[model samples]
Target: MNEAKKNSHMVGTVSELSVMLEYAKRGYTINLPTTPARYDFIAEKDGRSVKVQVKHGSTFNGERELLGFSKTPYNKRDVDVIAMFDSNDGTIYYIPTDHVEGMTSIRLRIEPYLYSVKSEKALIAEHYKKFIG
Candidate 1:
């Protein structure tokens, strides 16, 4: 792999590890896929299983105060949740896959803007924090 791709892979690896730790701490059992799959891993708890896709949230747009992450081409049946690792603040965010389905990219506003309409249904990073158990 090229340097950029290699570095990205490293980041993703770290993110997955961190997310696994979080899930384990919350009493969930973690399982890695034996073969190549769309999701990074499977997290099971209370007889429920969720396929998780790990993404490194390393990009931040200062002008818009938004955290940017590219949306992977995944169907609802392929992945259940997206775990985002915020490199800037070491924050882990869990977002339901359906929320970002069919999007090419995600630009999550970190904070609310005054001019922005409250009724707008934009993806806000803070809103996904509730998904973290």
Candidate 2:
């Protein structure tokens, strides 16, 4: 494989491992599917299962953390939650599928000073923190 593809795969694998660790730390049982699945893995707790799709968060234009979902169309039926790990901040953001059902990409500000007031209003970092669990 080319260097870029190899690097991307490595980042994705690391992000998935990070998400699995986070779920395990929260007392959830991690289950890996034996067959092809839409979501990456399932986190089960109290008999409830949450389908998770993990994406490696990357910096865009050296400012915002960009989470791209171009591999597939956003389908709420495919997964319950989307876990994005920001390598820059070492932080993970858990976003429900419903919130981003039809979106192709999500941009998050890693540094406050890099965003404008108008864009900042809609990209408040605090809004996504509550869903970290």
Candidate 3:
């Protein structure tokens, strides 16, 4: 791989590590970044299982925030919680599959969504609890 690709991979790895630590500090036991082997981290808390996808912030040069989701094809796997780490400030965020619906104003059409990360995570945990346990 080219140096740039290598560097980006390194950054992503670091970001995933940071994510794991954050979840751990929040009292969740977590699996490290083994994503694209699909799924980044699997966190378990209070007998709940939550799958997470960690992504770095978008590439932008201007001062304005370039907030948006990727328009590439997705399977059911990609629709789950997509977490992002702000490269500039390192704030972790959880974006659910339903968040794509918020793209009404964008050229890439998306559906309407209404739910917070806490709720989404809770639902995910409940759904996967059997397999996780």
Candidate 4:
């Protein structure tokens, strides 16, 4: 049987669900908002809650990729954390919105580029894994 085609909205929903599952597995209580809002979920644990915005990541070069948090900037009040689901490896990375405050997107590197002497500081996705849960 042929698989059904997926569009952006469908992909986004899948990403949100995937992130929700991950959060649940990590012992978080996932709460979905009833109305359309800036954040996708409100994850709570130990009496603490975080507003999470889910974004899908696309891979470019084999070693590096970019994840767009928003077309426009959003304040920390709108989203406490940005959960990026890597399409390539099924890895979900959590980043506090404050880290990329006022930015539209972030470039993620799998590893350092040794040959480039003036390489920009890399935002490795794996490093952000610590923010999960």
Candidate 5:
């Protein structure tokens, strides 16, 4: 891999490990896919299984956290949830896959703009908080 790709892969690995740790702490049984799959891992709790795709959030425009999700020619993946780790603040957002099913990217700000009535960052963070734990 090229230097940039290597670094990005490293960040993704770290993010995935961090998320796995969080699930482990919550007593969820984690299972890695034996074959190539759309999802990264399967987390099970109380007999329920959730397929997760872990991603690393990076800065965009030097302020917003940007997460890109796509499968080359394919726009969507069959996963239950997307767990994004913000490397900036160490915050993890567990978003339902349906919310971003067809979108290729999403941006999150640290805080809402002073003059704006709504903030995508705040809204996304708030909506996904329920899935964090």
Candidate 6:
């Protein structure tokens, strides 16, 4: 029986969209480039700019989340910082862009996750998924 194909696009809209918005709320300049592209947004804050491959776990749950955080060997292009985030609860875990072996849609990369920021603006919110680091 053809169980109705689950609509993936709708979920991506909810999750990835939330991730982008949360980044902006925290004062990083945000950008959404044309789709069918390499990454989702470019976030610049504290004099740093990054090519973020934003992932919506519920967004593209066909295993792309695994693509983002696989702790394996990879080429140098993956060195620009990568992130796997759960925006709903405002928690994102990231690492150097080259940690994972392969590439896929979703997995994001942002740098300098740890630093001394103004106490009032620290990203101390909670997230659901046990995000990658």
* Residue 26 displacement in candidate 1 (angstroms): 0.4
lDDT per residue (tens digit) for residues 18-99 in model 6: 6667677778887677765455567778887776665443323332233233224433353344445553444555544454
lDDT (C-alpha, whole model) for all candidates: 0.74, 0.75, 0.53, 0.78, 0.72, 0.47
In model 6, the Cα lDDT at residue 59 comes to 23
Q: How many Å off is the CA of 30 in candidate 5?
A: 0.7
Tens-digit lDDT track of model 1 for 18-90: 8888899889899999998888889889998889887777555563343446546646788888888777676
- lDDT (Cα, 0-100) at 90 in candidate 4: 78
**Ten contiguous residues minimizing lDDT sum, candidate 2:** 114-123
TM-score of candidate 6 to 2 decimals:
0.50
Query: What lDDT does model 4 reach?
Result: 0.78
Q: On a 0 to 1 TM-score scale, where does candidate 2 land against the true structure?
A: 0.84
Per model, state how many residue pairs clash: 0, 0, 1, 0, 0, 7
- Model 2, C-alpha of 97: deviation from truth (Å): 0.8
Q: Return the TM-score for each candidate structure.
A: 0.82, 0.84, 0.62, 0.83, 0.82, 0.50
Misplaced by over 4 Å in model 3 are 32-36, 66-79, 101-133
Write candidate 3's Cα lDDT for 1-133 as tens digits: 9999999789888878877788788889986554453467788888887777666655342522324344453333543555565566666656554644333111111222244333221122112112211
Model 1 TM? 0.82
Instruction: Judging by TM-score against the true structure, name the best candidate.
Output: 2
For lDDT, the strongest prediction is 4
Off by over 4 Å in 4: 1-6, 118-122
Worst 10 residues of 6 by lDDT: 120-129
Model 6 alpha-carbon miss at residue 74, Å? 7.8
Q: Across residues 1-133, which tens digit of lDDT does each residue of candidate 4 receive?
A: 2344457777788889999998888899999899988899999999999899988886667746655548768679799989888766778888888887887876666555657563364476667887655
